[model samples]
Target: MSLPPSYLPAGGPDPDGAAAGKRTYGPDFLTALFQNPLDPGYSDAAARRATEGRRTGWRRGLAGGSSALTLVVIGFLLVVAYRQTVAEEPARTKARDSLIAQVQNRREGTERLRAQADRLGDEVAALRERALGGAAIAELKDLEAATGMAPVRGSGARIRLVDGPTSVDAVTGERRTDGLVKDTDLQLAANALWEAGAEAIMINGQRLTATSRIRQAGEAILVDIRPVASPYELTAIGPDELAEDFRAGYAGPYFETLQGRYGISFEAAEVKDVTLEAATEFKLRSAAPSIAPAPSGSASSSGPGSPAPGSSTEGGR
Candidate 1:
């Protein structure tokens, strides 16, 4: 039998109509969503859960209580941790300040000691020069200059190296280290200079001696355990052809590679009247200068000004 018109879908072709037989359109999306806010699957799952809850009513209540207790415990732990951190902040701050102060004081003390040592060394040298005069003193002075035990002034080549700007990879978020100047680079440059006939060399005023060390400690480069800052300047005393020879040799090309590949800055040129400082002397308590009694009966040449060739001295270390 035919039903009432109200039972049919509104604003669309009748089901018995030919167009309705070909295709059908549902209610508007907003209207449908308002009518059934919950999805069919979610409704089914909720029904199943309700039925299971009814079956195990006591267990469901216990689980809910356990969850609430766990949340409460976690909140309490968070509160306690925040309180502890707040309480310890002052102590941590105080400790950090104390450490900074100590470091500053120690650095100042070290500077004072270094200055005092330099003064004493000058006084000792003067006394020795007065006691021993002539060829022996001259020879000793030559040895001192050769061994980097004393400062010297003359014409030489100056090499300057500077660290490049550090950049991070945009894709990988990794800091690039190749741009920074390394100890090996300094060593290579020094060797290159030496090969080109450099007699004496200094890095940022620190003289390079037989016992001198160039190494890296963490992020800093050190010469003889003393840290040197970036933009290292190397002064090498050598023949007149030193600068030209160095630039024409392997060093020039290698430095160019560094500049192109790593962005490090390099410069080499000849400089006049450049003075370099002496290396820090390491003294031994038991070491002493050996004095030769001058040939057979010869006037016992002055006193011991310096250690005889191949003999040990206080600052041998």
Candidate 2:
């Protein structure tokens, strides 16, 4: 049996043809061939498929843009880090060199100014010596000595005080600050030298005047408001027996106590031809002449009836 020709479309396969044989078709092909083109569901399905493809494309584009943005951000951060770590070294080195040069220049300027001041001071001293005679010069010398403005040299003693080695406390397991040298220690040592007939005294090249102050500022010891560090070298100009006198003074026993209790180090030795520099500056607060007043006239030498000098005798009262 053969199917009617009306069942096939134009130019379709002929069932009676010699080339006709048993043939098979896939389900997708048959579905497409028999599909209804005007169905509402088909149109809706096509629109849904198109929308899904567009959404997938949009998601892929968004993901690619985000990845590109992340890569750009990462690259920018790497550049900034490289500049900070590698490129900034030369710039910092240049700035440091500039600062060092400025400091050196300032130091040179200070040195020049100091030299000029010293020359001017010398000239003034020379002029003063020329203006004043021998007696005036002697008086000036005495004044200079009293004011600590003149350097002195003589046989005297040198005392050295140093901070003790750092030690941990056995009881508290804490570092002790008592072994450090302090301002009071320096003051006591200087006072002891003065009492021992020391004519001149210098600590760390700074001369001690009557107005000189030794004090503590935080952890530092300041002499004349200038900081000083250990080991302190105190040079005094006096007689050869100055060291012996100092050894017998209160400072010696105090220092011994400090050594025994706090472990402070101290040493004193007699030195010959010791020189002490004069103080840099001096200020006078009060001064007076040493002359005595004239004696008053005796009352017995004047007559009882005589009027006193510059006195007015009115009537007989």
Candidate 3:
């Protein structure tokens, strides 16, 4: 039986009865895998190279030389970087040591100055007491004590706070700063002590006055521009109920939350014979007579002419 035109054998005439031609299979996955695995472009390139003969020796040498030059340049750059790092290490270390030494020297100088100032302050106080009357001296001493200008010793409460562990929450995938103590936290703690009727307070030995500032500069906490590091210790002089009152205040529950939720360390206790130092700075508003009183005969003429004490006469100007 004769086969149909469309079902002709391999290397047969086309189905449309055109000239006889080689039968071809499209380059699908199975055809490429079993019949011709090499890519057609690579096969063509190989045949072309064979017809043209091998590359000239100089060209081959040029390709190999280019690769070798690239490797050499990369190796040189790596060596230079390593040597530069080694050479700069000592310089960096020396600069760090110099800065540390300067810091130590400045700190020692500051301490010496502070001691001298304290001695001068004591001398001034003694001279002032000798110049003023007994009543005036008593009033001045009371004022100084109340205004945190003079150190005092008494029963009081001590509060300590410290930073908690730094960690990311496993479930929430959030890093919490609640564990860190901030300037605001100390401010709140101080305010709470004041609210609890504390007569005098000191934070890390720095007296807390009305004009004193508790603030943050970068990661460090500053009290009156002096950096105070953690585990912050706060001392408050007050009555017997100082600790109880502080714990009842808002700062108590606030600290409790920090301890429970954020792992912050907070502690408070009452103790006797707590001593707080005087503040180094104080701001006072004073008034003095701006003009001398008139003579007895000219008293009536001075009524309108004499300005009140402490009143500025430069208002209009």
Ten-residue region with minimum lDDT total, candidate 1: 299-308
So what's the TM-score on candidate 3? Answer: 0.52
Model 1 vs. true fold: TM: 0.52
Q: TM-score winner among the candidates?
A: 2
Encode model 1's per-residue lDDT on 273-316: one tens digit a residue: 88877787643246456685557754321111112344322112
TM-score versus the correct structure, for each prediction: 0.52, 0.59, 0.52
Clashes per candidate (backbone, < 3 Å) = 0, 0, 0
Candidate 2 weakest lDDT stretch, 10 residues: 299-308
lDDT for each candidate structure: 0.76, 0.77, 0.78
User: Where does model 2 exceed 4 Å of error?
Assistant: 1-62, 73-109, 165-175, 285-317
RMSD to truth, every model: 15.4, 27.2, 15.2
Give the per-residue lDDT digits (tens) of candidate 2, residues 123-153. 9988988999778988998778756889777
Error of 1 at 161 (Å): 1.1
Ranking by TM-score: 2, 1, 3
lDDT of 3 by residue, 1-317 (tens): 76555456456655676644544444667866888777789988899889997777998899889999999999999999999999999999999999999999999999999999989989997898889978999998777777788888899899999988887889999886657887777877887787788888888988887567777686788888888988998898888998888888888888888788778799999989977878875665774665986777652311111222443322111
Q: How much is 241 displaced in model 2, in angstroms?
A: 1.0
